[model samples]
Target: MYPERFSNLPEYAFPRLRALLDHHDPGGEVVDMTIGEPKHPFPDWVPTVIADHSEEFGRYPPNDGTPALRGAIRDWVARRFGTTLEADSQIAAVNGTREALYNVGMALFPERKAGQVPLVLIPNPFYQVYMLAALSVAAEPMFVPATRATGYLPDYASLPPEVLNRVTAAYVCSPSNPQGAVASAAYWEELFTLAERHDFRILSDECYSEIYRDTPPPGALEIAARMGADPERVVLFESLSKRSNVPGLRSGFVAAGPRSMARIRQLRAYTGAPIPLPLQRVSERLWAEEDHVIANRALYAEKFAMADDLLGAVPGYASPEGGFFLWLPVPDGESAALRLWQEAGVRVLPGAYLSQTVAGENPGKEYIRVAMVAPKDKTARGLTSLRDCLYR
Candidate 1:
């Protein structure tokens, strides 16, 4: 009656959050920190850019991407990462990185590896799409803990050689979603080496790459180029969602080697919804403009400072290098979240929702993920409420 592969999948985090809290009345004004939706303003000119190209909406959009949009992405990559990409051969525009992230597993993961079902390595507390992507393709989604023990990045290289030999793809998120941990250059090198040794590909998710504190995090593409690694070894997915606060715009791209791009484009041609012409036009203008992104990053930087000032004294508080989440430790994630909602009306996500229980241990069991996407005053209020309610 149904695809059994997805039967055991836990409820998506947002629905699970509603089920956990919807019945209870908030004790105070509700300050939702559960979702990572950005409350900041996108560039003012984006609408104008879209309006100017609105006529193109009548035409079926280019499936892979418009040349102008691809060129804009290619140029931006060159400027931002110091790696030149062939717009036509190495890039394919996706509605958002989420879709690309999912489809990529389908397009790239082999039917079998080493005469066994392929393995898709995923960070334990990951973007939910990564797991679904693996499962949809019948690859065994292997969860490796990306906990404090491993510096908040998955230690893929630590896996046994037998397991590594079966890996067809490994997903790595820089400035990770829940943890906000950035992969170091050395970390990238080590992972890249492992991929090479094991003959697996790297699906590098850098959607949150633009939102960070201090130095810009090193990108996998640049690191791969530096190491003289196979171009096909690394495929990067980034979006304007977090970078420009345009999640609704659904604009992003997947960049990889020519051969990989061919497979991705082929899969996308059959089933992908191309970015609308007007939106692609807007994306082109947005990619060329950095003033907006810089301003957006500055706003996140302020929040990072606020988080550190408030929570740094807590025993396990470690300020994230990038991204908009505060992965704060508590005695128990679900209990702390319920307490925050019931006592303080601050809605935050239970970290356990984002991770799986493997062999009776869930890495996220002891923490809650708080999003800093709200405006400063509201974010401060939420953090103060949660801190006083739980950490105090």
Candidate 2:
């Protein structure tokens, strides 16, 4: 039977966007900036690598991941975050970060906590999967507002004692989706402290960890290592999607405390979908190399510069520090989205669609998330159109 908790879940972003704008013909040429699908060119050698290892695909892949892939991830974690993890002991491979993220709730959240219904704290305007994961685990999904006042990150510390007491897990996105806010090392420390105080697990989604403007954003694992925090209290999820422009590869990894990793591996042994062997080979190569990531970051940096130069003059423009989205404040997100489609022919996701109504107010109601994941010229054109039609 379907669960009642998810009965009222809002429709996903894209279908709702289609329902909102598909019927209306664009007044000008259409420029879609709604989804964060990467449009960059992946490494040329990727095809060759995959083809060379294609024969391995005939065999079933290991749920715990291969030594080479895990070791590569270990090295990547060390080089990027200055944190070390044992390849076989602390890490496990998954088909993608999305799957791992969902499964974590399944594997960790207990049926009851302190004789009370469990709670899952998630940031509003968050990745939709967080809410789904909570629902699947029968945990009360607590939507914490992540607004500009709070630096665009959720303030779980401000939660009431009762709410905090029941929290089983909390999902945090760095280089956050829609808003593109990067959580700092200080932020991670505070979160880790909160988890320690309340005795809950922290799921850090660092899928966009490699995409940044200035200095690289500090990661949760790095912060944990620095503080010598309880390793079991935190798990970091990462992917090669944005970092390597290999979303179709469907490969990612999770690094957790040894105990947590053991549980996750046990649960995955029965119900997990592992990455294919051939793609695992590709992932090993991707994680071992950073040249492509550097080039990808350069392209995004250029787009960010172009966006700043073009939209900086507009009122209420906040430049994103990391990730590839611009969360632009407009008069009304739904109206602005429709107006943009019908008048400017620019397609961007209405921020309202990404958030839930809390305390009779939707925090994302007045913003639109514009993805900077297009070619340079088209991105500029879309930004210019967005400016001329909506902000002008």
Candidate 3:
């Protein structure tokens, strides 16, 4: 007699992975590559900053964010995205990208669109929060495929006009989770165009924006500004987790147009747990510095090369362009994952866990997502074993 909105939801990705593999004995030394948690080291100065601001924890944190923290975020956006945003009016510091993402759906999606049940568009193999957020508001969720056929980004433009007309929002992740495929500038232009024509909003999750191989992924806010689209069209989310190796800090920010941002802040006021002031201070400094991020990116680049050296010859294997996950093709995701665990002691998440089975096809059924978040040597060993075990 509880709400059924999320009752039918499948088990979340990691738990499903645990259920699938935990009972097996490892055939070799275990090299876990399942979760995308950053293993890189954060800056040494972070602790000092946190300690200096520790006393502030005695006081209630600002609901939106401290002006100084918001200013730093605003500056980072301008520096990274080349678009200026008013810290006070447009930016809301969030606990993390997950909270920001869910709240976007809660605050922005109306109960009805054109006098009908609204549709909230989500990528098929997407961050779980996006779908959960839609369900939280009772919106009709539409799972669009982000398969390799569509360059691993959802083809929202291909949907029928009737479907488009009812869309209240579409969630897009660039340097997408699982696939690590990035959206190009042209892609952003077309998406913004579609949003404008369809009269819907775009939730652009850019948490992995800072982790790339060569070119930085084009940002939603920057692209919107470039096109002179409505400031409200693209709601942007970013986090310091990957950028600063501070997932534990759980500091991120959401930016949108004045109206939409106001709604987001209002909703957060009641339910959101503000980032501890000390961590916010740590975040301020983290945003202002990029040395650690550059070093971290270089480390990822080195590991990706290791993966390429090991698995480059495997058919259908393309190294990720950004972020830290490898979506390797398999005959059957769960089967491959079990074999990898029991036979090779290499852990990975089956693609089915991250995707919906639509019309009998789970988009991720033939894939296993391996996180390259371990140390370089460990990553090399895991990739080598993965290649030897699966692709050899």
lDDT of each residue in 285-364, candidate 2, tens digit only = 99999899999999999999999998998887889989999999998999999999999899999999999899998989
Q: What is the C-alpha lDDT of each candidate?
A: 0.93, 0.92, 0.92
lDDT over C-alpha atoms for residue 319 of model 3? 88
Return the TM-score for each candidate structure: 0.99, 0.98, 0.99
**Highest lDDT against the true fold, candidate:** 1
Q: How close is candidate 1 to the true structure, as a TM-score?
A: 0.99
- The lowest-lDDT stretch of 10 consecutive residues in candidate 2 is 1-10
List, residue by residue over 1-392, the lDDT tens digit for candidate 3. Answer: 76888789998999998899898898799999999899988899999999998999898999788999999999999999899999989999999889999888889999999999899999989889888898989998999999989999999999999999999999999999989999999999999999999999999999999999999899999999999999989899999999999989989999999999999999999999999899998988899998999999999999998888888888899889899999999999999999989889999899999999888989999999999998998998888888888987
User: Every model's Cα RMSD, please?
Assistant: 0.8, 1.0, 0.8
- TM-score of the candidate numbered 3? 0.99
Please state the error at residue 173 of candidate 3 in Å.
Answer: 0.3
